[model samples]
Target chain A: MDLENQKRVKDLTEEYGPENVVVLLGAAEGEASGIAAETVTAGDPTYAGPLTGVSLGLVVYHVCEDEVKEEFDPDVYDEQVSMMEMVLDIDEIAEEMQAIREEYTKY
Target chain B: MKGAGYILVHTPDMITHYGTTQTSERIVNPESEYLKNIEANLRPYERVRAYYPNQTYIGNITPLELKEIEGPWQDLECPVDERYGKYGEIMPQDEFYLLIQAVDEFELVFLEKSFVEATKPKLEQDPIITPYVLGRIKEGVESERIDDMVASEDAEGLYMGDKLVGAVKKAHAFDPNLSAHVMVENLVSKASSALALMYAVKNAGIDRDEVEYTIECSEEACGDMNQRGGGNFAKGIAEIAELSRSTGSDVRGFCAAPAHAVLVAAGLVKAGIFKTVAVVAGGSTAKLGMNGKDHVKKGLPILEDVLGGFAVIISENDGVNPELNTDVVGWHSVGTGSAPQNVIASLTTDALDKVGLKVTDVDYYSPEMQNPDITKPAGAGDVPTANLKMIGALAVRRGDIDRKELNAFVEKHGLPGYAPTQGHIPSGVPFMGHARDGILSGEMNRVMIVGKGSLFLGRMTNLFDGVSFLMEPNSGPKEEAAGVSTDEIRRIIAQSLRDFASGLVEAGE
Candidate 1:
């Protein structure tokens, strides 16, 4: 995850309280998406830069995950993120996001 | 013996406008939300001077002094005209602008005639820039040329007090690597690093000509399209700093570069390869306003406004200054798992174990010392404090300290974060000047300097990188002939001969 994005996630979690925040990741790779999800839910697993040891424990989901896709307006999701979704392995990304959220997310 | 002297230079003016985050954002979207909020939060030179961390950075105040002050340092002011510090100085943006032009050998940087005329006198007053260096500044061109270049040639305009004062022209026609913005960023790194080198030479009380080798370890890469990361920042910085005798190269490991470079310098000195080696790095404009959006949103001052540069002179054992003990350097190996516990252990306990020392033995630990005022608002929390906690936890795991004593251990060995998050700037090297002072004054026996980097950012490998080494008071000068006098050698030889004769007699009997 980008260091600035990590900061934003942490700031937003603090501002709205962790229970109110939900991180939506858009990484094409499962590992990348999982890492971003884990950074917000747990701390940065990579132990790199600012997010190291900073566990916000916020709810997180990948854009390709069904839970997130279901929340979006069907036409809007199809119009915006549908093209990239075809190339990405949705199952792999969704599974990784689920795994991270289950292990680390507190709310 | 290693690490003869050290100095750190802070350039607060380059942060907001030139930092990579702001510049890259502006390039992608000129009307970005971050850019809109930047101007309002941009800190003036006066406020930056008054900021406690800035004062501590320049050595205007000590770390302890900064710790004693109240929270939200932006609200508190410690106004002073002094720009110099025991280690280095906090240079204003105006003089730094002149320096960028002065150090520009490629003619990429151009200043407005009136702006130069107005600022040259002030720059001339700087004690570090000798007349020979001052003469390097070219007479400025008209604002018409700057305006034309910015409009047609895609030059990045240089601003002072919101007034167009100069511009940096792109070096290549279409190569993104040599774009005007990149050139300005690289030049800023080079010039600020050179300023740091100048201070290092001055503070070390050595002639610039005595420096034989320089290693630039900044995050910036100086290269064209063919070899995108090809670099010679070391020689580039040396040239501007008037280190005529210095030959050098660049080392890149993201934030870990400084620790690597410093270790390499120490090795070179210890091996008698070089009498004096200087590890120098300039600040990144790209990182200047890295957390500006967060600071702005939080109604806090843009704390990431400083471009940080530092130079450490490593020479053959001086018998007085603190020596870098390279015998037991900590390294995060290729196979080291990327777990936080693993990273901290590799950099702290693993290294200490090699020297038969425990975590509690090190008087101080300097690791990513990013100022909390800047990072806390940015949601990074206190970076140094986080690192210290990890180290402390490791200590508890190793039975070096009890869990109940963790806070006390952290308070004793850790310093408050004060360095700007200029990538390599904050990594372990910031406390070197203080460590040197502490060792010399007998206040501290040893300090561990650790640098950690995220290699995944480069997309090459997921493996993390880190290195650490100890700086301790020199154990006096090495004696001639390994401390064995000729008379002692002769006496030993005689004693051995007598013993041999007695043994022969016994055997014969």
Candidate 2:
């Protein structure tokens, strides 16, 4: 690893704040994503193609039960699934979203 | 703009790991160590097997053509990491019983064994509810056979779970109750995902009201890829959960949604307009794609899982989880991102630039944690792990850190593989909750949470990829300038909010 690239990233960060900086994730899937990547990264000399990500699913969520139906009855199982309520509280961001939801519902 | 005020880390209720091994044949209790291991992983959270009404043929749509399946999928051709193909291209696909996980209540110290499993299970072997319901509906309509799908607003008698459950029941027009005992788990995959997410909130002690926004990330096939019917019908799952109150929008960003979600939460909090935002994602077991039985006959384990789900809460409020660096630098900058190749460069550098931290300053980088073993079964090679290595190498190249150091970072902090290849579920950002916990406990400082979405995978043209990193310090709560009670604070803010609304109303004129 060389300090030159580090400084380049450093200077770029200074010029563009963290919110505005665009570090390309070198995930090269084909089709539109490939074209977009080429247009964005290859089009710009500053674009960094090599990138990475973490598989957070294993960390945050886990399999509580697999192969559920072999022993369980689907009718009994679905009843339980329905009995349990699924709720998402949006009041937290109600201020900005009230209008959008109303519009979406109208659509 | 500034650091999050209070961050909370939740021990997941359960890590519902499902293995891919079932064949298309209607095998009864077949033996496969992979299948056994999957069952072993899901033993914690109360797993639900919901019977989705009008599933059509989710239970028996095994693509049996690609026959001649065999051993573990990883043992097949193109085992290398670079091979790219839609996972569903493989086969031996069988009926998928979507599994969902959640902790009954909030708790930390993630020893998943202590987590309670969701009791909701999907469709059982016998699925005869549709005929029964159609008979019931015949009492009112002239035709016993349904001419239009539930989407037809004019259809007199309709039954799909939603807010109209009460109205439908009173009218006796729809009956999900008749086929009872012969349960058929509906493709309520999103609900399964949400069930697991609620645990992240409660176990982490996140207040439902504290969450100002919820960013839901799932596959392009979510709600069946159709605009209207995809949302959990009749159930009004989104509203019942109260994901949005008077504020917030349902952000649909494909696989990159989880990352996009967290960034949205962070943005709202940083702007001081909101206090909390939770980025949530659900699972879809039916994406068994076109592979399934075809792969099974071809000797590949069934890539579809019976269950799995994950969620992370990001907030500016205190007492829930450790706050991520509120200073966001780059967001794949729309037209300036790559597919998966450039995910790291765009994500890592963007955040580092905000705090003036170089690539090496990133104590660690985490990416698509897709298990190669699972993905290979689906025809999508080792994509997740490949992203991780790329970032580690990038750290070394920048001279910001050494190759050994970066390698050590991944080796030590990297999560043990467990999640099923549930498309958007096992993405890079899922680890943020646990990593944030580790960071606060002095395990590390500044973890880079990079998330990216594949818009092209959904066949959407003019679409672009999105990636962003959430940076956090390895320390405890930071001191604030002053203190105020929540009620008083809410009142004060509400007054301003009321004024802001009034202004918007006036301006609209």
Candidate 3:
């Protein structure tokens, strides 16, 4: 992450607490393998540093892992340190994600 | 049943090749986060059977080939065991690239001169699609102009791998009204719809000028900030396909938009408002690889790569084609609660009840048929199966079938889902062309298309949305025309005048 975005992400994490701060990494505009707009939420095992921050880069967090996913490990994967794309209200983001999941979920 | 185009554009899988280390180098900050930790050795995406060539994807197979495909191409296995069938040929990536360029040309998507020069030969050599390319390609914009425009940030280039295939120039310089992203998206939407319409015109045996109106039901919004979602994807598409006499507009309801459009188009044709009306949709880029992470994790190639588009034409009931049973309409009203069972019952059982039809009366049900392969690894289970089982359960509760007969009911009524995950593209419209063929051939008595939407996504409302209608074999004799003919009016007027004159003479005497 750039110094400017790094500072912004740090400030956000401080304000919202590390548990609530979710980071999303967007593949640069022309990457061949990963989807250009693929997004992964940062948390317990997966949240690490050395994030990618480009245009439309941002952070989303203040997530309750229990409510959102049964499990999330940022550390098990490469630590993500992407630039803050957009810092959304964590609860709202969770609700939206949950809604999307429910669309395909059976009753 | 007019025509359908299920196209597949195979992309090269260079990006998915595992064991290749890719490093991004930044000069200013050599240790930039993007350079330091992006996944280097990524697995290459393999071409799946469904993506290669088959009847399910209308594009690889032409309308003629599609006509030859037997009904119920989807296997009826408990878990979908196969993705590809023996119906159509799989188009290779290079050919698809040329096809997309041809499509761009058809829509007047200008390319830099050098780019066109490099690509022109590849397009010419392809015997299969050469005719299409020759028929569509027009004049090219100079590469110098493209360079200048890109330098000035006035255009966005269309990239395939590292190659710059084409670019979208800004429609206007000072029009914040037309941002680059909006222009690009609209351009893509327009080009795709045009390709589908072209196929439809040929497949449906209808002249381009015969279409009187069109409805573009894609989820993409074309207009600017002042009127964000205000659109005419219909007019843009009609213009491209040379629908000389057609006029059009757009309707949006997320995934349910196509079903709503179908209902609207059917009503228009049945009411004699127009001889032929079309409901068309183009795919979305945002949805491409939407579930990629899960697929990648499970060692599965990204299946959502294809940008899906479809077009359905509703025309005058010619006794041979299937009729849109307008009376048997289902709606998910505002008060219809959001529970899954409630939604299924409201959109299916209740509507069928109103039409005096039992749950088992309909031969087939097409709900949100998102391909399970793409959703399953993502932890979103078999969506089509879930829908079918719910309908079966409802049938059981209504005494339409025994509890033990639910699996049989599903097997009889449902087919494996084959649609891409483009939100609106999969909502009950993919199977329309097949359904039309079945009904016309006397193989299917009734097929109901159910379109459901999550209205709360818009943040303005919490209510869920849905609309469904049945298509059946044309029970001969068209529904009454919406208005009386001029000759009928004249006869009525003449009789009334005579009666008045006779009454006047009698009173005078």
Best by TM-score: 1
Looking at candidate 3, what is the lDDT of residue B435? 77
How far off is each candidate at the interface, as Cα RMSD in Å? 17.2, 19.2, 18.0
Candidate 1 has a DockQ of: 0.04
| RMSD values, in order shown | 13.9, 23.1, 15.0
Which is the better candidate, 2 or 3, if ranked by TM-score? 3
The DockQ-based CAPRI class assigned to model 2 is: incorrect
lDDT of 3: 0.59
Model 2, position B311: C-alpha lDDT score: 56
State candidate 2's DockQ.
0.01
User: How do these models rank on TM-score, best leading?
Assistant: 1, 3, 2
Model 2 root mean square deviation, Cα atoms: 23.1
Query: lDDT tens digits, residues B134-195, model 1?
Result: 89888899989999998896899888756778899999889999999899889988888888
Give me the displacement of residue B411 in model 1, in angstroms.
0.9
The regions of model 2 sitting more than 4 angstroms off are A1-107, B1-187, B206-212, B220-235, B242-248, B289-300, B337-342, B377-379, B399-417, B462-464, B474-481, B484-509
Q: Model 2 chain A: which ten-residue window has the lowest total lDDT?
A: A55-64
> Candidate 2 chain B — worst ten consecutive residues by lDDT sum?
B83-92
lDDT digits (tens) for residues B204-318 of candidate 3: 6667788999999988886666787779889877777778899998999999999999999988887789989988887665565665545555555555556567788888765
lDDT of 2 at B354: 70
Q: Which DockQ values do the candidates obtain, in the order shown?
A: 0.04, 0.01, 0.04
